[model samples]
Target: MVRHMDERAGVDPRRTDELWLRESERYASTHPRCLQLRERARAHMPHGVPMSWMASYFAHPPVWIDEGHGAHFTCADGIRFLDTNVGDKSTFCGIDPEPVVRAVQRRVAAGSQFMLPTRDALVVAEELARRWKLPSWQFTLSASQANTEAIRLARHATGRRKVLTFTGNYGGHGDEMLTAFAGEGRLSYLGLTPAADRDIDVIGFNDVGALERVLAAGDHACVFTEPALTNEGVVLPEPGFHDALRELTRASGTILLLDETHTLICAPGGLAEKWRLEPDAVVVGKAVGGGLPLGAYGMTAELCEAFERGESLTGRPGELATGGTLFANALSMAAARAALTEVLTPDAYKHASALGAELADRLEAVVAEAGLPWKVQRLGPRSGISFGGRLARNAAEADADEQPELNALLRLCLANRGVWEAISTAGPALSVAATRADVAAYVAAFREFVTDVTGTG
Candidate 1:
């Protein structure tokens, strides 16, 4: 007799290779195109895609998209979806908008990259200053580079070797950022060298006392943070928590680096402008490039001067661990310029922010009616649904439960029913490109799925 896994909160442990294989068999029967493409990808591309993160799309291989426009992408089989996983938030305006597409088309005709600098980069830097109120800026190809560069700037200027971050934080895969806390200590993710272990420190988020103790004892260069913990799965800062953190970092002379790669989905200005956050350095990547690969960091004039004066940690500057050869290529720059200027406007935020709340309400109502033990959390437009009622404030809380069966069921159900989701996020948050009705469609699908799966009569 097959044991029925009791539905609980968090990620369920019912998922194994056998279960996944069974699901894959079923998925392939319907999505023949996807199966064929996945097999093709496996033949050449490791896991069928260049990016491993993309490969980690729950169980089945993610469907390959043919093209995207407005709020959705058309998959290889010509299925148009409400694309919540907009290039994993890289497609800020959803798929491809006309303005961004036109800009790329026009710029492509003119030229792509020239290796020197373009007028767009200058405009982008000025836009950074104007919107973020920071004085200087740098560019790169991905958020990882932006973050690594920020740390380099911090350590160089301060001559401090150590960096600090909260537990359950996701600041990109720079070497220093791999440290996660175990009890009171930090542990490096495997294969990282000894130097990474020595230089990075960890503290618990929203725990002021631990932070104070760490800061007080530290000779640290910078404190890297997400305004709210996002990667360990969408945790938010407690009220006044950020204010206190800012004060503590200032007191300790530790440069505060805010990584806004995911949080930018909330609005045009991101969390810094939205919450009036003040950081010595700000790193933003992903969506800013209008789906192109782009990463950027901004700082004040003083820090820029320190960098210029050779006070930076780079006493011997070689190939920057912070970037690649095509760091600020013109194609990416032109695309970013268009996105920053035209796509991420105030009106878009109003739509997405409002839709985010509505989606949560709908989900909550459906869950309550179904008696499913689940909870959803949202910050502006960035939202997530987990397996419990109490919202997770830390990584531990977020990890307290993992409903594997539910997540898989939900993903397959939604995809089969004509809605697409990340399985990690709440409602893919609303995009400027989304119609009010388009955002609601996911909520409706969820309600229907819960009723159907839970056998709620």
Candidate 2:
């Protein structure tokens, strides 16, 4: 059973709330420029920001980014921060990587889009196929689209309409994946209109028995999930979990589709390659375009053949509704090509892996010394800090470890102290451009926050 937030995690909720209020006031007073901009921009943009999530990023006004380079960025108020956010794991190779920038610059001059295939696109597809060991590839503007298309392909191939996804696993913003299981197995949606009411089902993460039972019904077209649930704070797969999953899926003739959008930071070829877990279809986004918007999905030879048969039977060449006009724009292809070839090389992964281990060790030590229950879980160069001693096995336990007010307090503290953790729910991502100084800054801020809030120094 998952422990409640008030249980085990040694946090004084009242004190933390008080500190959050005090910090919010301090942030508002100090960043007057940001405050003024937020007030003025509210007339134009929703909640004074373009994205809805920006409104909930802070108790006070969100800090507008002035500019970013390498492992750090400056806010609108001229306060520079050591960025552990790394564009919410999108800029995993670091910002403005020279090769990607140069490639995009050249491609932009030649042509942005032409509704025709480019040499760079072919090269990128080949590289992705080489990395993931898949035979065919398709591109989309975002991971959500990639996931949506992958689902469509799975259903078309299997003649099954239902998709089984683990609870708390996020695969973009597709309507089919937007549904979540409320407590007691009740289903709910993030929006008013349900994206998938009858076609999508929720299962337990790492529960091979549950997976086997569901797939045994022979009703699900695909099992869509991340190798590990990163969205809910890094719920790892249990031992022998993948072995059972593969056996069950194969036996039941269900396609296993792994979403590696955020997990791309986990390894050079992402977690699928690192762990030697083979899936019929794979989806990747975020860092694929070297900080630009691009997502790709790779299909095994069998799935590719199935897709081709579906396309032929449909009687339309490009009207499958799987892609948009600018799905594979030349600029995005060029950037992805440079990113896969020049930036995210083996050397880069080696360096980031070492750095991530060190960051996890240091953060864990700090928490231990403070006598806190928090545990730091690292996935390659990225890590998440959970308010529990043991790592979560599923989304329910992962959600139980979350303390929203405490999360806000820590994020505000890190921001105020010159450290930026972009995805506040997860952990920090150490980019290739990140230096020792950046790591030190992050450690220092975490130490200060832990000691201050827990009074353990």
Candidate 3:
């Protein structure tokens, strides 16, 4: 039986395919410059992009962006697009935020990096501690690195060899956190050995029973999770889920590590602060540096003390568990200082959250007017339309709710009409620089797409 039968029946797949064909033709005709660039790029780079994933992630050919200002960007074709994706939330503060730009400029002129720490590192760490309520902090080049280091620290502090994660959770690209549960066994991704799976366990989100069962083993180092499942389309935790998770992990002597990298969109302090979560450690990245490459992990003072007493992997005494040559570089620290103090302020979050709510409401109304069995799921300044009428409770249901053909058609339609939505797996999000006008533009394009797909016009 099809789980999303109502959604499937509302819009005929045959009509969707036909409209997709039309949009594909329109995209090809209108984006000649992007096409030419792709051809030229293919001669030097694989799949016409520096990153292989970028080559086929979009419904239409990837548009070459010339520049971005506040809430919009111009493509190589001289067309401006309302940037709802915001670099997949990497530029959540908005493109070229003045304070960050000025800070970066000064840092570059002075010096970009040194193995030594700078005053900005102290300032950034202080700000992060203040916001997250964690005393000790460390930096890395990306959230993936932060997560990796956090896992190692957890292992060191607890003398455990295993890790725990929830289903549909993305805790960076690290090998240890990348596997998911398959039946009674684990499913490791390519390039990962079965050895990595031996120490990892995956369970469904919001399943307190499963979490308790796994943590009871008493050999797990940490339970890594987001405040909510953002990458799998904003699957929020049920009421009291976090409370149970914390209680269970605490009782079992397992560390609770929350990755707030994407969930930073939830608020200035991310969901940890917004929800008053008391995680032992928190990981953050992406927009925290105003789009510069910066990631940080903060630990409670107790955990910090434990980590200090712990030995390094090489059996060195009194050495910290993690450090990188370029970690805490001057440039990243400068940008983070500016971003936290000036760009991602309370007022900016207020504006972005308002715009996010407005976009979700408008899209929901559009679906209702079109009489489609779809709904918009929102998290803070982020929102995405799920094809199913009800929200998904777990990863399996979320995966089942996916309508690839419909998603691709919607993305291509929005792209052709000058709104750049997020990639297929993610959703549109408002940046701090977004305005009502941008939200309206996105709604207009989305409404048109609905009309075309459902023949509701």
Candidate 4:
């Protein structure tokens, strides 16, 4: 667990609280259009948004987005947001990148789906193999689907029923994965699943002891994790954390599954390649489809051979090496192909990384100069600033000291300052577009919000 160095260094906690509260009130007062959208949306949307997670923010009602272009979003009120959230990091190359759009348009005149795999799927699979160093690939509709499918395949290959994961990670809404640990202990979310059997085990990301204990059990099919658990406020890995993890999983005879849904912002081949960490399977979705719904799991040659030379005697109807009809629909394949071949280049990433780094550095400078108790964490092109000290590790780190009320206010303060992003924008695998002016505006917004909240020059 990473202790809050800021807290250990004796930063004042109450100062953080007061500043965030001030920011929140200022935010609510300025966004009447968002409030109106929330009201209209509530009549139809179960939680005032299509997805319940959208409503989890401190804003009682969330801002409604109208449309997006290269790197900007216009809200219902026509105010342009810097587009940091980018539909939850699904817009990796920035929204509707021209090549991807053209690809989609050209494919749309032909068809949307055929229930038969498309030729673009072949191209995508080949490019994925070339880039990710995996010989085989399969597609699904979402990251959750890909993650669960990878788990099932790993279990089927090993003849193990149990799955293992880090304590605070989200790998889609898979039944075995929708569990979280808290003040009491592990429990199911939305009562979706019962603890029929503890088939899944949770360990802290950087905790070697906890990981060793879980892996040594020898019954788990795989250890699934993000390179860093950026989902819960960008908990970066310790030095050599992933290398040790790779070694341990190999020694323990368990497969390592890396979920790159959020880390695509880090590298073209995702965080796995950036760190030179090898895993048995990699599930990457989000940006692969270029703002469309697409998911894929890439695996090594032996895994491909396992499917090819499987136990015919033990084969079941819905066994491993399985997929659905619409797995690689034409439109999704077209976008995926364009995104990989054209948009996701090293140059694109270098441009984004520079802007993101500048924004993060500016945010840290502003907060530190103000003597605020908050801290910022960044990975690749994404970054998030927390109102409390540095988060430790996973959910436990979140629980111990974070004041959500403060974070809520901070997000509002930011929105009020014309910076529209998810509160966890920095950590949620998002990036501002490469344009320096947009990046500068985002920095200006944060600085203004901080100055407003702290009531200092």
Candidate number achieving the greatest lDDT relative to the actual structure: 3
Per-residue error for 50 in candidate 3, Å, reads 1.1
Tens digits of per-residue lDDT, candidate 3, 1-457, equal 1222334437887788788789999999998999999999999999898876575667577988899999899989998999888877889999989999999999999998989989999999999999999999999999999999998888888878888888888887766667543313333357766576688888889999999888888989899989998877889999999999999999999999999999987788889989999999999999998989999999999778777774744465776558888888999999999999999999999899999999899988988888888879989899998886678888887877888778888899999899998988788999999899999999999999988988877
After superposing candidate 2 on the true structure, give the runs of residues whose Cα lies further than 4 Å from its correct spot.
1-7, 57-60, 181-192, 310-319
Which candidate leads in TM-score? 3
Worst window of 10 by summed lDDT in candidate 1: 10-19
TM-score of 4: 0.90
What candidate 3 gets wrong by more than 4 Å, as runs, is: 1-9, 181-188, 310-321
List per-prediction Cα lDDT, in the order shown: 0.75, 0.83, 0.86, 0.74
Task: List the candidates' TM-scores in order.
Answer: 0.91, 0.94, 0.95, 0.90
- Pairwise TM-score winner, candidates 3 and 4: 3
Ranking by lDDT: 3, 2, 1, 4
Q: After best superposition, candidate 4 residue 288: deviation in angstroms?
A: 1.0
Total backbone collisions for each predicted model: 13, 1, 0, 3
What's the residue-level lDDT of 355 in candidate 1?
79
Evaluate residue 37 in candidate 2 and report its C-alpha lDDT on the 0 to 100 scale: 91
CA displacement after TM-score superposition, residue 362 of candidate 2 (Å): 0.1
Per-residue lDDT of model 1, residues 1-457, tens digit only: 1323444642233443344455456667767897688788898888888776666665456777788777777778777788766666787677787778888998899999778788999998898788778999899999988988888888877778888887777677755576543323433356655566577777778888878888896588888888987665578888989988999899998999998888887766689988999999999998889888899999888788776774345465433344567888888899888988888888877887887787777777877777667777787765667765667887766656545456666777677656777645333556778777876788887776666555553
Residues 1-457 of candidate 2: C-alpha lDDT, one tens digit per residue? 1212475678877667767777777787778898889899999998999887677655446788899899888888998988887877889888889999999999999998998889999999999999899989999999999999999888877778798889888886666566643423433545635445477778889888888788889988899889988877778898899888888988998999999998878788888989999999999999989998899999999888877773533353432448889999998999999999999998998888788888888998999898888888988887768876679898878776667667777888888898877665577889888876777789999999998788665
